[model samples]
Target: MTQRREAAIEKTDLTPLAGAETDVAPLGRQGLKPPHELTADEDVDVTQWNRVAAMDEFKSLVAEKRKFIIPATVFFIVFYFALPVLVGYAPKLMSVKVLGVVNLAYLFALSQFFVAWIIAALYVRAAGRFDEMARNIINRLKSGRE
Candidate 1:
């Protein structure tokens, strides 16, 4: 029973209703019937794998990417690279007299973490919203309506 069940699951139909007594019948083998290809009835169907559909998808992908790449590159340079350098180098020049007790470098270094947190928050929000907008535009264009 287990062997029959395994065979039924692994191989194509060999049940009694299929009129075949063997489950391991070789298709188009020597001295056997030939393997069949798709008949006439199945060839009349049409779908969107043609050249026009492929070109449309490629163009949509490119347009969606531009909405994200330019602004992100600018933000990465300013917040990640330029800001840190400015902080490290211009400590004395950009000192803040928060109070008589606290100096500018001390305040800046201490609040570096706050600046980092704000930048990260802005990035996450912009990324989520921008991706949604891009996807919506791309989907609209794909359907040939936008």
Candidate 2:
């Protein structure tokens, strides 16, 4: 068995597969260097990052993101868990008919999808502002004004 395995391994091609090159930019390239292509100098500078993190603008950016994220996360968690919780704890209340045969629970469950979409839309809108703030920071860094 060992000899047979060794013979099979010897017969197999050992050459590395060539990846198809494209003109398309690497995934998630918003003016950031591709991970695989970064050199020692291009790699993240801890001191620089620390300096930027200490900046009031960067601090505010972090706070702003946290403000949205924390509440959104909490709300999503509550909204998602509420369905099962309510159904389990308050069956009769959930069973009441709202529109023909559909109960309050069904409506509430269906509404979660819309709520998620609304949250996503809000985040998308908020992200545009966040991106602008980030761009401003990057510009400041590049212009040596930071």
Candidate 3:
């Protein structure tokens, strides 16, 4: 082997440790085994999945999520785009000073960061309720009550 190649390998600590077990696969032109060749234990039941999907509780959960998500998405989109749109169409209004040097445009731009954080916080709070509803649905399914 080249001196440079040996030096590089030593620097990387590629040498196997003493008394350590290794199950390294042989290198081949095709590399590792194809994903399809890998086997996983079957744990999911199709009937259970279908039952969950058909439940009114699940439908309500989806609707509850959409109620918050749809409006939040729309509001964010409008707010994000409004800056550029206002700057282009209403430059005079955007340039109006609010503080000593900071204008409405600067304030609005800075507010976007706070708005995004607020939205994230709101989602986290809402997600807790969504999780509780989902848990109740799962418990009902597990107990075979409905």
TM-score of each: 0.36, 0.68, 0.66
Model 1 lDDT, full chain set? 0.56
lDDT of 2 by residue, 16-55 (tens): 3232223356677778556666543334554677878888
Q: Which ranges in model 2 have alpha carbons more than 4 Å from their true place? A: 1-39, 42-44
The full ranking of all candidates by lDDT, starting with the best, is 2, 3, 1
Candidate 3, residues 42-84, lDDT tens digits: the string is: 1234457788989999999999999999999999999999999
TM-score between model 1 and native: 0.36
Cα-based lDDT for every prediction: 0.56, 0.80, 0.80
- How do the residues 45-123 of candidate 1 rate in per-residue lDDT, one tens digit apiece? 2233343345654556556556656765676567556546766887665566776968766665666577767767866
Better of 2 and 3 by TM-score: 2
Which of 1 and 3 is ahead in TM-score? 3
Error of 1 at 141 (Å): 11
The most accurate candidate by TM-score is 2
The Cα error of candidate 2 at residue 91, in Å, is 1.2
